[model samples]
Target chain A: MTLHNKVRQARTQLGLTQSELGVKVSVTRQTVAFIEKGEFAPSVALALRLAKALNTPINELFWLEETAQ
Target chain B: MKQFFSIKSPLWQILAATLLYVVVLLITYDKQHSTAEGFTPARIGMFVAAALAILYSIIYTMAITRYNKRNPHDKLSITGVKPAEIRDEDEGMRMITARATERVYRYHSFALPLSMVFIALSDASAYGVSTILFILTLGHYLTFWRGVWPAFRETSEE
Candidate 1:
């Protein structure tokens, strides 16, 4: 029922902290933290921005586990 | 004058207001306990304290307005635009606050009926118990969301 993301992995892989990612996406660091923890789902605009910031495709970054089939 | 009034710190402002409310409540209780005396000093003190509390709320509203203008687009503007401000604006905190609000709403739904039952069966002052519970619940949510939750996030980062 929720979207899962590899935000933390991608953020770390790019040598970026949560704050840095949030800054790039015009969001708060805690938002980045929640999104990574699967506690909050990001809007499409935010997802795309996050992908661009991490230099990854949106699909690779976020997915719905329940709808994987 | 403007600078002094607009020196915004939301958590402290809320705490001050809560303290003022408690003072007013205590003064009223004292007046009621000695009601045989017509319009005692405590009765006057209660009105004065209540008036001060109302003034404090007006000041707080003004402070919030000034702060929000100074830091437009910043969600935690009342605390100013510091690096730690990010914690207050975090989506996680917002989500947690939303969940807490929902829980508090449900708590009130059950608590109201239970309180009515207790009041009917006892000599407890309905107004006193209701006021205390309201303040406690409000203080808990405000402190957690505005003070503790954000501080916890900021500390974890360090």
Candidate 2:
């Protein structure tokens, strides 16, 4: 199972740069970029913060996917 | 410009200084041993390297202090900060640091015994022991940076 997020899409819709979103969520810009790229899975608290910063529902922002091995 | 003064910058400087000190120590070990005189050119070189290392450490401390002062809300603990700490800027970075630290731990676990074996095999002098320690320190930083630099680069590029 992989955690997938529409953070980039949501962030873009809100016209927020990675740095701006990072500032809002108290993370580094690189962390925001990593999340958008699906390279880093944030903790639940951070996920909630990202959701709040992007003004999206956490369920809508992130989900899990089952990949066939 | 900001990147130049980031927390990582002082770390890099310290690494460079340490590397120089180690190189000088290794290169001068033989000459210093052979000389009866207390102050040879090699000894002077080693002294200079040690001085540079001390200077860089002072600079690192000052930089961290200044950074902490400037960013009170994001102040880093001076005593707790290691070169591998990077920036505890977010969960992702903290995770990255954790991974790097794990690598360092594994590296030392393996390297420490090996180093002891090497130290035992060789007639361990103070110079020899210090040199090995310096090399090990360099390897520690290298292992940490190996895990971190790629992520840092990717983040910077974005």
Candidate 3:
């Protein structure tokens, strides 16, 4: 299973820089970059915080995709 | 000057000091075993290197504390004695640190017994044993630094 996110799209639409979004969610800008790149998966708490910061629902922001073996 | 107090500074300091100390130890090893004198010039050089390492550690701790005071939003730790990369201000950095330390732990898990076997087979002296331990310590930090440096660069590039 792979977790995918629309964090970059949402964040860009909101005119927020990664650093500004990080400040809102109490994470580092690198973390925001990772989340957008699908390299790092956030915890549920952080997901909710990101959802709140981006003004998007958690489900819309992130979803899990199943990959074949 | 600001770069001197950056999060990666301690690793650089540790690498330099460890290399200097180990080189001095290797050079002085045979002399110490062969000579009856307690304080050879090489031995004095080793002591001076050690003293400098200790002094640098104290200054690094103070710099961390001052950095925390200046940037409250990015405070590293309450005590300021911990390395900044390990006790970073956010979860991403902490996760990176965790991964780096995990690699170090795995490296030591294999390296420790191998080192012990080599030491026993070689009939290493007390000085040789200590020197080997110092090299292992340096390896630990190098592994961690290798793990985290790229992430630090990626983050700072913005």
Candidate 4:
């Protein structure tokens, strides 16, 4: 799945609000919104932070099309 | 968000169409103009317009398009570009950039000597249009190179 579900899923799992996730990821909540909507891609650095904050490995947090293909 | 278009296709189309327009304008100039001076002003204007459009395209691609691409610095994003063994990848970019500069410099440096022939044979309007076209194309490359150097090519250097 894309980042929308991923962000919502992760946020719920951690019981974090958008603002809290933003604080954890060191981005603005609006930036988090864009990422969740797949309008913007987070940098590799930010992705690692998000994965760490959610207590999940990076791969589970993101799925490549190549995997399905 | 609501709409999207392929980036490179439109630019390549524009380049091809502009070249064709220039060729057609050249062929039709004498038939359309009783005096070469009459053709000079508009030809120069078209050249300027084309040049500006090209420059705008490059700048838009570099700066505006960045938000759309996965951040190269982010490690966890799907499309994020990992910084590998290369520390300060821009140094690699500099080396490649130096090589590219050498190539472009050599190619464009011979331009004046070649175009000097046109200076004598060309009508004033023809000369003006030609010079404007050259200036605009050159300016586009100068801006394009600066933007590309810091972004794409720089990130993937040797």
Candidate 5:
């Protein structure tokens, strides 16, 4: 299973750049970029903070994708 | 001076350092082989310091390559990016680095013993081998540690 998130969507919706979102959540722009690209999974605490930053719920922000067998 | 340094990329910094290291190593080797002087603490210290610098440059090169590949367009001066940023921005990168480092450690575990056997059998300097290995192992560990350390930090502050 892979974790997918709507961080980019939400950030754009809020008119926030990756760097801006990262600042809101106390991370670097690269971190935000990675999160958006689904290359990196955030810790629970970070996920919660990210959700709060993007004004979305934890479940709405991130969900598990079922991989092919 | 800030702009002066920024003009040269991390790649350049590494190339320059490595080139200098080679020259120094050659000089040291020539001195040892040609001179009748015995091994001294000062000589060992000079080699150790030089080796450490080269190892640091190598690590810097890896980090710069990764950062440039990730960021693109913009240039980050050699000292600009923090280890936390590298770890934080790329989960895939961290995983890849961790896996590669582990593989090196595993190989070294076997290679080190073999090296010891070779050292004993041949005229290899045990002190030199030990020093090089110590610096190399420490550098690898430091690279990984710097990456993970921020994960344990409190999330309250940036």
Candidate 6:
């Protein structure tokens, strides 16, 4: 499957609601939801914040089908 | 019907409502205790609810400020992606922001009605029904607004 950002997955794993996640990352929960749905992309800082909040690396936070090198 | 729901009106509505709520509390307080007996749970709750609203307002204002400091036309992410990659994700983001806000308003609207039902159940001898409604309204709306933040980044033009 095409790998999307692990925000929704990692969020569930971390047991944080979007609001909680938002607070941790200094964003509104709406931002979290949009990122989770792939409807919006986080800024570099936000992406980094989210990754740190979720305790994952940015590479893991967002990844795609490994381009067949 | 659409003409009825103007943005300008909500500010007025919120202000009028808070005033009416204040009058109700004051009148009830005057009727009861009538003396300088102070610090009722109802009053405390009213202050707390007001405080909560103020807190949310502060946070929102600060966030808006922080947001504005950023480049409005900046690319999708802070990540070091090339320009070509940035455009697509940025477009997707704007779309999410636009749609998410509508959802926030819609969901919060549904919860507002529950306040009436709760208010009806409130006994006069019991805690203030209005206080309960106020706190719940603030809390739920906050939750809803927070819940929908992700989508708010979605631009309208999709």
In DockQ terms, which candidate is top? Answer: 2
Residue range B28-143, candidate 5, lDDT tens digits: 66566655466555466567667767776777667667757876754455656443223323443465446545755775677668767876777566346544554455544454
Candidates' DockQ values?
0.34, 0.63, 0.50, 0.03, 0.25, 0.08
Measured with C-alpha atoms, the lDDT of residue B85 in candidate 2 is 44
Error of 6 at A64 (Å): 3.2
Query: Per-residue error at A69 for model 1, in Å?
Result: 16
lDDT of 1: 0.64
What is the TM-score of each predicted model, taking all chains together? 0.64, 0.78, 0.80, 0.30, 0.50, 0.33
Q: Write the per-residue lDDT of candidate 4 for residues B24-109, one digit (tens) a residue.
A: 45545644663666547657656666676677557544632453464444222223363121112223233434554565566566
Is 4 or 6 the stronger prediction by lDDT?
6
Q: What share of the true interface contacts does candidate 5 keep?
A: 0.11
Q: List the residue pairs that clash in candidate 2.
A: none
| lDDT-superior candidate, 2 or 4 | 2
Q: What TM-score number comes out for model 5? A: 0.50
Q: Model 4: runs farther than 4 Å from truth?
A: A1-69, B1-63, B66-68, B72-89, B122-158
Taken over the whole model, the C-alpha lDDT of each candidate is 0.64, 0.76, 0.76, 0.52, 0.61, 0.56
Model 4, B14: alpha-carbon shift in Å? 8.6
Native contact fraction per model: 0.39, 0.61, 0.32, 0.00, 0.11, 0.11
lDDT per residue for candidate 5 within A22-53, as digits (tens), equals 77887766567667777678888889998998
Instruction: List clashing residue pairs in candidate 4.
Output: A43-B74, A44-B73, A44-B74, A44-B75, A45-B74, A45-B75
Give candidate 3 regions above 4 Å deviation. B1-5, B8-13, B16-39, B73-81
DockQ of predicted model 1: 0.34
Per-residue C-alpha lDDT of model 3 across residues B1-158, encoded as one tens digit per residue = 55434755446547555756665674567466547467766676667777776776677668767877888887765464665657355677777777888988999999999999999999997677777888787788778877676455564423
Deviation of model 6 at B55, angstroms = 28
Q: Model 4, retained fraction of real contacts?
A: 0.00
Interface CA RMSD of each prediction in angstroms: 3.3, 2.1, 2.3, 14.7, 8.5, 8.5
